[model samples]
Target: MYAGAMKDKRSDSRLVLEKVSHSYGAVPVLNDLNLVVDPGEVVVLVGPSGCGKTTILNLLSGYIEPVSGTVRREGIIRTVYQQDGLFPWLTVSENIAIGLRSVEDPARREKELLDLIALIRLEGFEHHYPHQLSGGMRQRVELARVLAGDSDILLMDEPFSALDYQGRLRMRWELVRLLEKRPHTVVFVTHDIEEAAQLADRVLVLSNRPATISRELHIEALRPRDLTDPAVIGAMKEILKELGLQV
Candidate 1:
């Protein structure tokens, strides 16, 4: 669901960076990086570990500032992390409510919360604490919380990495379902080649260190993309080759 293109006539980008670079205690992590994400497109950053993937997510989410460039964002941003990023003490409903409470309009907030609860399929789990819920449920709560904020862009850092195979599979379908209604641009960072292929409209491959763009992939197939089809295999192979990983 490439939600929509960016609003800027200059580039159709909802978010952009100008020659962005970053460092860690004098050690360069990302150098001369520039990227643009359309308003509703999913851009996945795929690379080996320690290749500055998470750093890129951080820069976009405003958790960290760049050392040598700029991040331009068109709207409010929200993030969902691999760890679920939920307050264990809070019930699922509470977590979802916290973000909505800030919406300023009680009527709108109530309506939005109900819609998000239904979207995440967590209506009955509302009173359940994070520890009481399964991993997938916790992830849903995190997603719902992010949605409740009504952020224009969603940043996810391997939110499915910890899920079991079946859970991951279901989450992928659920994500497509959820996004269809929410329709927000997303920047997801993952090391999984197939995950990028399944979820992103565009996949940006990165170099080993001091990460830089290597290849940009466009998955033109329709969704529910067949996981084992030759078409998917061929595109995955091409991306792996571009990343210098033979498979």
Candidate 2:
């Protein structure tokens, strides 16, 4: 199964950052950073608190421009952040249907929204408002809404950081299943090593201020990886080491 999944991966570049550098009013963030995300690949960025991980996402999303190098994005990009950006007045189904507002066929659009609602496992709560759902449920709605847009690349900035321990774990699996059904080139940013190890196809560790690529680790484990598995533990340890931790 692992080999099959790997074999089906896309070989083309979906996003690339070459010698990218950025600064905020003289405060340097990324410095000569280079990275590439292939089509259908999930790449996670983890680093110190001020190490420009979020800055990388902003650059890819075109929210900010790089000062030095180039950011090449090959397809449509969508983002899912730590906060659940849902409309309080809209019901779950209504919020997800927002992505299909451009579709001219009502039947096709309704089918897509219903499929997404089921994919996120929120079928029965379609009529519920954002304020009525739990943190994890809200994040699921956010993800469903993004997937409904059929984006080529998904830029996620700590989307699950606010969840409790078990909630985060469950959501990780939830994400894997969703992507399996509808593949998207994903760039995820997080400070949690375990999260990176669990969700990434490749994990890139960044340096401190004026952050550059410190180390790149490929996660060869299959889906639904056990958090306590020796491979996962080892991967987390290596990430910690790159961050200057004694472990």
Candidate 3:
């Protein structure tokens, strides 16, 4: 696992949500929300199941407009959801190649796809179909597909939620390794505090419906963090407390 590199102070804010609020019909989901993600920083959102976490991602991705306030994005955004979103008929290499479709040169596109497959450690399975790979491998392909686009920001919503415990642990470490190689401003949403503690540079805790920022905690521990370490355990406890969970 790569150590958590100190974030460069010069990196600018890539995404900002200023006093943003959103609703479905008459029911509000997010209320007066404000967030800023610096370039190459990983921020995680954790809260009650329906506290507008996914709504925030939708707003950031421009899939939906905020009912009030402003949503400003400085660069291209890509999203990875809980589902892999892989094309059943396409091989791993082919699915990843979808992101490079706009590349005019066939040779250049192929080279890029090959490089991405290597980056995600899918080199051996490039020719394998989605059904042939494990769930974790499929998710890796999804991640590689997103990264292949060279997006400036990544919005991940419970991306590893469907994986088994061991798979989730492995993917968390794999994610850190991948991000170290290809950095991006990331906003990840997860219900798991341990996951948030393990991945986030900063974690934002949200309230129930009509969600608002309830608390913000920064994880100062280095990456490849040990779950048993006092710092990590302390951070997890604090986050759970914020979420009204007894530790």
Best by lDDT: 2
Task: Tell how far residue 53 is off in model 3, in angstroms.
Answer: 0.4
Q: In candidate 2, list every pair of residues with a backbone clash.
A: none
User: What's the distance in Å from true for residue 214, model 1?
Assistant: 0.7
Question: What tens-digit string does per-residue lDDT give for candidate 3 at 1-247?
Answer: 2234424321543889999989999999999999988887789999999889999999999999999999988776889989858999999988999878777888999898988998988778988999999999999999998877546688999999999999999999988888877777889999999899998899999999999999999988877776687777888999999988875
Clashes of each: 0, 0, 0
- Computed on alpha carbons, the lDDT of every model, listed in order, comes to 0.82, 0.88, 0.87
- Please identify which of the two predictions, 1 or 3, would achieve the higher lDDT against the true structure: 3
Error of 1 at 54 (Å): 0.6
* Cα-based TM-score, every candidate: 0.91, 0.93, 0.92
Report the alpha-carbon TM-score of model 3 versus the true structure: 0.92
Of candidate 2, the 10-residue stretch with the lowest lDDT total is: 1-10
Model 1, 1-247: lDDT tens per residue? Answer: 3333323321333889789999999789998999989877888899999999999999998899999999988777888999859988888878888768669988888888788888898888778899998999888888888767646788999999999988987887788777776677789999888877787788899998899998898887765566786656777897889977785
Q: Give me the runs in candidate 1 sitting further than 4 Å from their true place.
A: 1-13, 229-231
- Let me know the TM-score candidate 1 reaches against the reference structure: 0.91
Model 2, 1-247: lDDT tens digits are: 2234433433343899999999999899989988888888899999998789999999999999999999998777889989858889999999999977767799999999999998998989999999999999999999998888546688999999999999999999999988888777899999989999988889999989999888999988887788997778889999988888855
Which sequence of candidate numbers ranks them by lDDT, best first?
2, 3, 1
